[model samples]
Target: MDTSIFTDKTIVPEDQDLIRELKETSVLWYAIRNHVHGLYPDAMDEWHYSGVKYGWSFRIKDKKRVIVYLLPREGFFKTAFVFGQKATDVVMESTIAPSIKELLKSAKVYAEGRGIRIDILDSSLVDDVKQLIEVKLKN
Candidate 1:
């Protein structure tokens, strides 16, 4: 079986260096995939963001709605989730990790919702990220 990522742009697929970059992150990405895909098997989509400087957004979509945005980093990845007032209350009430709660507390509030970004270094944080996903899906 051939496991490779084909980019949205022909320009991207043609670049061997870009393919290698994707390959380098494959292990970590697979760790992420194991957790996310287990819960949201159908949420997978080729929803790559355009002109990303650092890495890509691995979005889990439910029809037209976006559940979460997983941004890949050098040796880690960041999960972006937006929570409304009610969801914020839920997060505050939940027994998530202190660091994650601190992140929630400091997250910038916008008109739409409070945007929370969490960086995950290893598979250990997958459960927390999933909880955040539950918060995102709640609303």
Candidate 2:
């Protein structure tokens, strides 16, 4: 089965479509978006279709710098972030989560930064994402 609900390249997902697929987690999705906008009023969000393998993803950017990518799944969503050396160090020293820290430790380093994608399954995980966002913006 496809991981994302919106896989059709010809079509774009609307707010109602997201609500139907995300269900309870839709609250988290909106919360995160609102949080980012609250932090960076000028943040711009756009949806992109990354072929069939990746499907559709919502990307948030603060001016030219990307803040995060929200990947919608069946009942939940994921948040992808790329942190530079400084931001990676901050995350390593943060109280985010051991698994996440481990993910960071093992994440392949790209020219951009160390990429880590986390599943925002519940409210507790949302806090971790928020912390990561703060680290990303600050560093």
Candidate 3:
């Protein structure tokens, strides 16, 4: 089954749809989006439908470089990032949480970078995601 809340290819999710589907977690969603935009004025975001398996996702990018992919779920969202060797090493060494570090370590290294998807169930993981975005921008 498709994990994303917005699975219908014909229907693109609007702000109200996300707010309704995500409920309280929608606050976190807006927080992160605003945080990214605040930090990087030129950052651009777009929605993409990656077939049936993955469904719809919102991608935030800095010009040509992708910063993160926000996947909307029923009550929460997942942030995906691709970190290069330097950024991965930085995250591994930082004080971001053991579980997240492990996720990065175990993620398969592709031509772009090591991709990891972090589920944002609550506000606890929001800062971590923002820090990771900074790492992505710096390295």
Global lDDT of each candidate: 0.64, 0.90, 0.90
Per-residue lDDT of candidate 3, residues 1-139 (tens digit) = 5379888899989999999999899999988898889889899989999888878999999978889889999888999999989999999989888889999999999988899989899999998888888888888
**Residue range 5-121, candidate 2, lDDT tens digits:** 789999899999999999999999999999898888889999999999878999999877889999999989999999999999999999998999999999999999999889877
List the RMSD of every prediction in angstroms. 6.1, 1.3, 1.1
- lDDT of the structure predicted as candidate 1: 0.64
Candidate closer to the true structure by lDDT (higher is better), 1 or 3: 3
- Per-residue lDDT of 1-139 in model 1, one digit per residue for the tens? 1112333433333224433554544455555556566667777654464543333356777766677866654445567787888988888899888888888788888988888777666667677777777776666
TM-score for predicted model 1 compared with the true structure? 0.71
All candidates: TM-score: 0.71, 0.95, 0.95
Error of 1 at 83 (Å): 1.2
**Which of 1 and 2 is the better model by lDDT?**
2
Model 2 steric clash total: 0
Clashes of each: 0, 0, 0
Candidate 2 Cα RMSD (Å): 1.3
